[model samples]
Structures are given as structure tokens and as C-alpha cells.
Target: MLANKRILLIIGGGIAAYKTPDLIRRLRERGASVTPVLTSAGAEFVTPLTVAAVAGTPVHTQLFDLTTEAEMGHIQLSRSADLVIVAPATADLMAKMANGLANDLASTLLMATDTPVMIAPAMNVRMWDHPATQRNLATLKADGIRVIGPNEGDMACGEYGPGRMSEPLEIVAAAEAALSDGPLKGKRVIVTSGPTQEPIDPVRYISNRSSGAQGTAIGKALVALGAEVVFVTGPADVPPPEGVQVVRVETAVQMLDAVQAALPADAAVFAAAVADWRVAQAASSKMKKEKGEIPTLSFAENPDILATVSQMTKGRPPLVVGFAAETDNVIAHATAKRLRKGCDWIVANDVSPATGTFGGTQNTVHVISDDGVEDWPKMAKDAVAERLAQRIAGALVG
Candidate 1:
């Protein structure tokens, strides 16, 4: 899919810089031409000669090289590519990009580029979780920059969390998706997945059995179809899919806010199994056992995200799809939910223990609409997502 594409790759100053040679090789294997830009810090981890050898192109490292400047200015080089990618985008680099600082070659190229940009972040767990880094990340996303991964794993720092740069193949897939001109090209979608956690105290919370598999699949499917997807997700067993804008939230209220912020999209899919209620007054600390006495708790209803979005008088998505996980009377309940929630369609599934649907790979679903219910045979969650994505594409593009 990336045949003959030009990729301007910026290698940041991080331990993950060692992987850029492999990333360059992968991009070349798929018929992409990569131009490497090595930061001074990046050169400490990987030699410029190695990068140049793998990419089969001269590495550009200096912002003010008199000889190179005469041949091609930084602005011209930046604008010459179809896409610019920053691998192992360090915290400092991200901060520079977010704050629009152009003191160096990498940041200068990033600031000058009109081509779409994707970054694969790599940092220590603490740096990834720091409020300042997260704030910068949010700023970058808001500016329409695409983020690949910072997958979770043991880092070079011997710590574990979400700060690992994505594997080379994953970055390739994301790059292809970013450059795709599929049926849903130019369309925007919002997909909510996973189960919201309602905190009862500092440690305990109320949640559900949602694994986020289906939602993640849906996000992937949409991206494959060339739609710009804003994935609003809660805590789930599954990680958010690559190549889509991911918004993480912990409660129904936060999910709603994220969804709304991602709006003005062509479609919105409410696939999350959000908690329906939360403790009205949760304890500040862990509730201790008190001599065989049960602690009484009051419940408050969570906001109905589907209903709120579906009933929007202005700026409502053209197509609003909601999911219903019914234990019994699947079609009956789901059909009623369609009318009650004021959505365009309802994807209903039986989540009873017998169905093994909730954390399982296969799913049997009924697509409920005003016309009637279409019972679909059991299939893998990925297949279901692909089918649903096709239908969404048809609805939006046709």
C-alpha cells in the first residue's frame, strides 16, 4: 500500500533508537523510500552510518550544514515527503513539537512539514505517566498529529508500563492506514469501548466484564477503511488499537466528555459497556471490615451517553450506533433500546454466561434498526467489526 511513498523518518534520542534501522528496512521492504534524520542524541544510540546503510539514503543531522543547505533547505526537505514519522519520539522532542520550538533540525522539520505526521513515543514509565508529558500528548493530538504506540512492556530502564515504542511492523501498518484512500476516506468516526470504572474508594471500583476486544476490533476496522477514528476507551483487558486517535477515560462521565470532544464526526459507535450506576458517596479510604457489619452504600445513575448523543439537537452525528448486551430476550430488549436511545442502529449480542461473548473471541449479534432485526451468525469479533465497518462506510459514503 505504501509503494513509492516517501517517508521522512526522524530518529529521536532514546534507547529505542536502535530499532529505527529495522523500521527503515521494513518501510523499504514495502516499497517505501525512507530519508533518515538523526538527532544528536539519537546518534549516541545508533550510528548515522548504520541508519544511512539501512535506509539507503544519506542521513540528515544538521540544521545548519552550509554544504547540505545549499543543496536542499530544511523547509524544502520537510515538505518533500508524503509523510513524516518520528520514531521513539522522546519526551523532550514531544514537548518541543507541542510547544512549537524549532531550535534543532528534527523539531524544525516537524514544525515546517505540511505532510501528515505520526509519532511513536518511547520513554520511561514515569515520563509517560507524568502530567506534563500527558498534557503535551493531548496537545499534539488536538493538533491532528497521529500517534502510533508507546506499547506497554518492560523498558530499558527495567521498568514496566506504557512507554515502549511500537514494533516496526506495527508502525508500518499504522503508516499504511494513515496513507490509505479507502471508501471511508475523509470521514471521521467516534468509537467508545471497554467498561467504565466507578471508583468506590481510592482502590476499589465498580465495573463490568467488558474486555474491550470488540471495541478495539471496531476501531481497527474503521481505520482500515480509511476513516479518521477517535477511539474513546475505558479500562479494558485489551489495549486500544493502533493507527487511531485514542482517548482513555476511567468513568462514564469522562467517557462522555471524551466522546463529545471528538464529535462533529460522520458516525458515533457506542460499544462500551459503561457502568450504569456508581456509589453516590464513596469512602475516601479503603472500607475496612468492622466486626461483621456490612457497609451500606447509596447508588446514583450514570449518565446515558447513547441517549445524550443520539438526542443531540445540534451537531449530532449522522449515524449513531449503540450496543446492547442482553442476557435474555436479546432482540426484544435491543429493539426497545434502539427506540429509547434514539440511535440509528443497535448492535445487540447475548452476553449470558452460556454465550461466552463478553471476553470471548466469537460473537453472535443482531443488528437492530427501524426496518427490522438482522440476525447475524456467530463469528469472530474481528469479522463482526469488519462487517459493521462496511455497513457504516456504506451509510456514510453512499
Candidate 2:
């Protein structure tokens, strides 16, 4: 995915700096050329020689080096890469980057570069959890810096928490995402995921069997394609994809509200398994059957989120995609749903117990549109999402 990409890798001060050589190797294996910059404190953990040996290039270590300065100034150096990555982003380096301090070569290059930036944080467990560090992280995120991980593990300091750097391959994947020149680049998209819960009472609710695997994968694929994603999610089985705006909701009404609020999107993918009905009047407290006295409940039709978004005369997305999980007549039902919901496309999948699609990893879906129904072979949910995202990107580009 990262073939021929140019990366400016900045090594920050931390014990995790020792992993930089491996990271460089992994990135190079994926066909990315790494230009290394080593901070003074970072050099303490991993020498420039080790970095150069793995990267197969001279490492940048000073802001005022005359030899390189005369050949290519710091401004050129900063502008020379497609993306800038900070591995083992120390708390001090993060503070400087967040506060716009440029007292050193690393900070100065980061400040000068207009390139997209991603950071992999590494620090002591306590330091990683500190309020100041969190504030800096928030600031950096607001400034559009993508963060990979400070994965939780036993640290060199004998602390176990979210302070370790991500593995080299994971960092490589993040870099690929950052450098991807997919067709959806710069497009804003909204994806609804998971099963919405309609409350029956304080403790009881109506929901579906959806595990949110498909939707989460869709969001990840979209992010990989460089789209700006607003992920409006319900109660999900999987955690949300990194580097996207996440909005959590519960009921179908709440989901609709959140979706409406995230308007003006280029496309909207309604992959959530929203409940069809909700309690008309839920009890204030949980109800119990006492002495064989059964309680009666009334149902109300939920707001049709897909139809509402699709039929919008103003601020409607150019493309709208919906999912239909049917037990029988899948293609026909999905076709009708596409027309009835006024969506551009409907992904129809059989969810009969025999198919095991409700909470399973694989899906056999048919794409229904004005063009016609296209039957897709059964595949992993992630593969389905990737195909769908690619098609969406194509539609948007067209």
C-alpha cells in the first residue's frame, strides 16, 4: 500500500526509541523510503549508527549542521517528505509540538513541515495517564495529528499500562493509511454502525443480533481511503476505528439526531441494525411479573433514518447506502427497500440462523441499485466492507 512513499520519521526521546530500527525496516519492507531524524534524548536510547544501518541512509541530528544546511536547508528538509511520523513521542516532545515550541531540530522540522503528521506515543504509564499529557494529546488531535498507540504492556519502568509503542507492523499499517492516495481523499462521509437499542425500561431494551463487525470494518476501509469519516455508532461489539470523529448513540431516534447533526456529508452509509419498533411508553422503572400477573407492552415504529436522510431536499448526501438483513427473498426485498428508502444502494444479506451472518465474520451480500442487483460472493465481513467502500469511492469520484 505504501509503495514508493517518502516518510520523514522523527525519533522522540523514550525507552521505546530502541524499537526505531525495526520500525524502519518494516516501513522499508513495504516500499517506503525512510529519512531518519534523531533527537538528542532519542539518541541516548538508540544511536544514529543503528538507525542509519537499518534505514540505509544518513540520519539527521542537528538543526545547524553546515554540511547538509549548505546542500539542503531545514525548510527543504521539512518539505521533502510525503508524511512525517513521530515514533515514541515523548511527553516533552509532545508538549513542545502542541505548544509550538521549536527549540530543537525535531520540533523545528515538525513546525515547518506542512506535511500530514502521525504520532506513536510512548512514555511512563503514569506520565501517559497524566492530565497534562492528555491535554497535549487533545491539542495535537485538534491540530489533525493522527495517533497510533501507546499500547498497554509491562514497561521498562516495570509499569503496566498504555505506555508502550505500537508494534512495527502496526506502525507500518498506520503509515500506509496516512499515505494512501485513495479516490475518497478529502471527502466527508458518515457511517452508522452497530445495533441501536430502544429502551423498554431502565434496564430493558429492544435490539438486534448485529455485532457491528461490518460497520466497523467499513469505517476502517473508508479511513484507509483517506476520507474524513464521522462514525455515528450504537452499542457495538467492536471498538471504533482510530482517526475518525466518533459519535455514540443508543436509540434509533438518537442515531437519527446524531446523523442529522453530521450533515453535508458526501455520502452516508447506514449499516446499523436499527430496531424496527420501540416501546410506546416505557416504564420509569424495571417491571417484574408478580404472582403470574403478566405485563403488557405496546410497540411504536421507529423513525426511518435511511428514508429521512435519503429523501432530504436540502443537505442530503449525494450518495446514500443502506443495509437489509432479510430471511427470505433477499434480492427482491432489498430492491424494494432501496426504492422505498430512497437510498442509492442497498446491501442485502441473508441473516437466517443457517447463514450465521448476524454475529458471524463472513457475509454473503447482494448489491441492489437502480443499475440492478449484483450478487457478491460470500467473504469475510472486512472484505465486504472494503469492496463497498471502494465502490462508494468510485461513485463519489464519478
Candidate 3:
């Protein structure tokens, strides 16, 4: 699973740094290219020559070297890997990362790299259990850096607790998982998010209250599962997720165009709360206040993107999921919408004012399909997204 993957291994100063040479060997055995970065303290435990010999690559130990810098700049080195791993991530190193300090070469690389990062923490029992260390760990996790283990057992300092770094083989396994293309890997998926605006005039437009939180979460989940996601987003309160190709549009028509351009996907999830109608004859200029005069405006129906894609004769995705954000009788309305829209499934949710489903963080939804409706409990937007993505993966794999 780790075949041909590029790993930037940053070794921190710790007694566990000795285990990293074996970690590099096992990774190389699995066809991964291991690039080593040895910290000053780390070099005290393991020589650069030993690290280089095991990795079969030159070890990076300096922040500034004319010879290497001319070949590959620090920024390039930081971003030129599929993953960045910090084995024996010391308390000092973790603290630097948590506080965004980039004084040293290792910390600089960690701050600059856009690649995924994983850490194997090793420290003294008391240090590992310190409140400051715990807080830093939480911050790192929240930032999406994966943590392997600090297993409980004997420590090199002769103290017993959860301060030992995991064995080399176990760390290798985690690395493989991190680099592996998941079940949905190589699959292309289209996700539409947020609310479209229908222009009423140059200065103003009509739009929905969708914050795009649900859609952003869904995109993140899909990417985590290794899917190539094309995220078509409208103007929203929440920002889009990282690690996906984003296509931004303002109106329903523009969104449809973007979606059509990103076609030939394995699946399509229409989560955008697109405006149903648009001003047929909007004034070119903003209407000014006038006494005893009321301007009348006509409307035209906007394109039905979900229905149009669901019923495509050619190049239709294998799975088509539409969303029904209704105010009342959500299940009944969503079930009917699924059949009418000719979509494979409909995620139905109540968006009534009382429910706070428009721009809220949590959601209670039902998954409606030809089989039946599955009731999902209210949960955080990200949890809902993960469950939905897993279900999609199963359907696609089957």
C-alpha cells in the first residue's frame, strides 16, 4: 500500500529516535522513499550516517546549506512529499508546532508543508502527562495531524506510563494506512454546496440561508477516503474545505455550468440550496425610492440541476444523490422528491426556522432511497458527512 510513496521523516530528539532507523528500513522495504531530517537532539541519539545508510538517502540536518539549497529550497523540500512523519515527536517539538514556532529546520518544514503530517510521540511519563503537553496534543489533532501512539510501558528514563513510542513495525502500519488510497481512491465525485444567488439587480440578489457547512464537511470526508472531489460551491458563510478542487459560482445557472464541466464522476451529491426562480426582467440599475410608484418584477424558473443530471442519457454518474431541505413533512417531501427527480437517493432534512438547520452546526436527516428511509440521529455536521461518505463508499464498491 505504501508503494512509491514519498515520506519526509522528521526525527525529534528523544531516546526513541534510535527506533527510527528501523522505521525507515521497513518503509523502504514496502517501496516507500524515505527522506530523513534529523534534529540536533536527534543526532545525539542516532548519527546522520546511520540514518542515511538505512534510508538509502541523504539526511537533511541543516536549515541553510548552500549545496542542498541550490538543489532544493527549504519550501520545496517541505512540500515535495506525500506525507510528513515525526517519529519520536518530542515534547519540545510538539510545543513548537502547537505554537507555530519555526526557528529550526524541522519546525520550519512542519510549518511550511501543506502535506499531511503524522506523529509518533515519545516522552517521559510526567512530561507526556503534563497539562501543557495534553493541550498541545489536542491542538495538533484538531489541526488534522495524525497521532500514532505513545503506548503504555517501560520508559527509557526508568519510569512506567504512556510515554513509549510505538514499535517500528506498528509505525510502519500507520504510515501505510496514511498513504494508502482508500476504497474510494481514484474515484471522482462531484459535490455541490452552499446557496446560489439569483440576481434581482446588479447590486442585489435573492439567495437562501445555506452556510455550506454540510457540503464542506462532505467534501472533506470524501477527500479523507481518497476520492478526487470536484467541489462546486456558491457564496456561503462557511469556507470550503482544503484538499479538493473548488469551482466557485454566484448563481444557479453558473453552478450548473460548472457542474456540467466537472462531469464523468463516479457519484454526484447535490447539496446546494439553489434558488428556484430568478428575476425575469431585473432593472439594469438599482431602483430608487419614488412616491406613489411601485415597481413590478416578473420571475423565471431556474434550471433544475439535480433533475437534469440525474436524468442524463449519457455520462450519468453511477450514483446520484440529491438534497431536500424542507420546512415540513421532510420525509414525505424528500421521498417524493427522490422519485420525481429520478435520483438514486435523497438526503432529507428539516430546515424550518425552529430547527436551525440552515446555518447550524448539527443536523438531523433521513436518507431516502428506493429501498426505504433510514433515520439518522442528530449529530455534528462532520459526523453526518462521514457516515454518508461511508455509505457511498459501500454502494460504489458493491
Candidate 4:
């Protein structure tokens, strides 16, 4: 899929830079040519000679090299690539890109590039969670830069949380998606996944059993079809897919706000299992358990994200899809929900304990629309997502 593609790969200064040689090799294996731009800090981690050797191209480092500048200016070099990728995009590098600072060759190329850009962030857990870094991340996403991963696992720093760079093959997959000219190439989509957490206190919260597997699968399928996906997700067991903008939220209100912020899309899919209610007055501190006494809790309804978006007076998505997880009478309930919520379609499924649909890999779904219910055979969640994505592509661009 990446045959004859030109990828300008920027290696940032991080332990994960060691993976770039492999990334370059993989890209080359698929007929993609990689031009390596090694930062000064990146050079400290991996030698420029090594990068040049692996990529089979001269490593571009100096911002003002007399020899190279005469041959090809930075502007020309930046615009030559089909896609520019920053693997192990450090926090410092991301901040520079977000703020539009171009002090070095990598940042300068990023600022000057007209080509689509993708970054695989790698940083310490604390750095990744910092508010400033997150703000920069949001800014970058708003500017239409695609992000792959900083997958969660044991980091080199001995602390564990979402700060590891994605593996090389995963990056390759994302690159393929970015370069795909599929049916939904120009379309933008919003996909909400996972279970929203309604905080009751500093520690306790109300949530559901949604594993986010289905939603993640949907996001991946959409990306594969060439849709620019804005994945607004909650805390889920499964990680958000690469090649999409991921907005993380904790509550239904936050999710709604995030979705609203990502509006004007071709379609919106609400696959999240949001908590219906939240504690009216959550305790500031943890509520202590007392012997022979039960604490009375007051409940308030959470925001109806699906209904609100579906009933939008302005800037509504062309197609609004909602998910209905029913215990019984799946088709009937889902059909009713499609009308009641004012959504264009409803992907309904039985989530009873016997079905194991909530967190399981397989699902039996009924696609409910204005025409009627279309009951689908039981299939893997990934297969369901692929079929749904095809249908969505047909609706939007066929």
C-alpha cells in the first residue's frame, strides 16, 4: 500500500529513537523511501551514520549546511515527502511543533511541511500527563496533525503509564492509513467509545462494563477506509486505535463537550456506554464505610450526549449513529431508541450476561434505521466494524 511513497522521518531525542532504524527498514520493505532527519539530541541516542545506513539515505541534521542548502533548501526538502513522521516525538519536540517554533532542522521541516504529518509520542509518564503537554497535544490535533501512540506499558523510567512509543509495525499501519485513498478519503468522523466514569468522590466513581473493544475496532476500520477519525473515548480496557485524534474524557459531560468541540464531521458514532446517573453531591473526600450505617446517595441524570447531538439545531453531522446495548427485545428497543434519540441509525446489540457482548470479542448486532431493522449474524467485533464502516462509507461517499 505504501509503494513508492516518500516518508520524511524525524527521529526525536528519546530512548525510543532506537526503534527508528527498524521503522525505516520496515517502511523500505513496503517500497516506502525514508529520509531521516536526526536531531542533535537524537544523535546523542543513535548515531547519524547508523540512521543513514538503515535508511540508505544521508541523515539530514544541520539546519544550515552549506553543502546541502545549495543542493536543496529546507522548504523544498519538507515539501518533497508524501508524509512526514516523527517517531519518538518527545515532549520538547511536540511543544515546539505546537507552538510553531522552528529552531532546528526537524522543527523547521515540520513547520514548513505541506505534507500530512504523523507523530508517535514518547515521554515519561509524568511528562505525558502534564497539563502543558496535554494542551500542546490538543493544539497539534486541532491543527490536523495525526498521532499514532504512546502505548501504555512499563516505561524505561520504571514508571508505568501511557508513555511508550508504539511499535514499528503499528507505526507502519498508521502510515498506510494516512496514505490510503479509500472511499472516505475526504470524510471526517467522530467515534465515541468506552464507559464514562462519574466521580462520586476522590476515589469512587460510577462506571459500566464497556471494554471499548467494539468502539476501538470501529475507529480502526474507519481509519482504514481513509476517514479522518476524531475518536472521543472514555476510560476503556482497550487502547484507542492509531491514526486518529483521541480525546480522553472521564464523564458523560466531558465526552459531550469533547464531541461538540469536534463537530462538523461527516458522521458521528456514539458507541460509549455512558453512566445514566451521577451522584448529585459527591463528597470532596472519600466516603468512609461505617459499621451498621448506610450512606444515602442522591442521583442526578447525566447529560444525554446522543440525543443532544442528534437533535442539534445547527452544525449537526450528516449522519448520526447511536449504539443501543439492550438486555432484552434488542431490535424493538433499538428501533425505539433510533426514533427517540433522533439519530439516523442505531447499532443495537444484546449485552446480557449470556451473550458476553459487553467485553467479549464476538457480537450479534441489529442495525436499526428508519427503513427497518437489519439483523446481522454473529461475528467478531472487528468484522462488524469493517462492515459498518463500509456501509458508512457508502452512505457518505458512494
In each prediction, how many residue pairs overlap at the backbone (N, C-alpha, C within less than 3 A)? 0, 0, 0, 0
Global CA lDDT of candidate 4, please?
A: 0.92
RMSD after Cα superposition, model 3:
15.7
TM-score of 4: 0.84
Q: Per-residue error at 204 for model 3, in Å?
A: 1.1
Segments in model 2 whose C-alpha atoms lie over 4 Å from true places: 124-135, 150-163, 187-213, 227-350, 359-361, 364-383, 394-397
lDDT tens digits, residues 303-346, model 4? 99999999999989999999999999888888888899999999
Tell me the TM-score of model 1: 0.83
lDDT measured at residue 242 in model 1 versus the true structure, 0 to 100? 73
Candidate 1 C-alpha lDDT tens digits along 338-360: 99999999999999999999999
Model 1 sits at a Cα RMSD from the real structure of: 3.5
Report the Cα lDDT for residue 209, model 2.
89
**Per-residue alpha-carbon lDDT of model 3 for 345-390, expressed as tens digits?**
9999999999998889999999999889999999999999999999
Model 4 alpha-carbon miss at residue 165, Å? 3.9
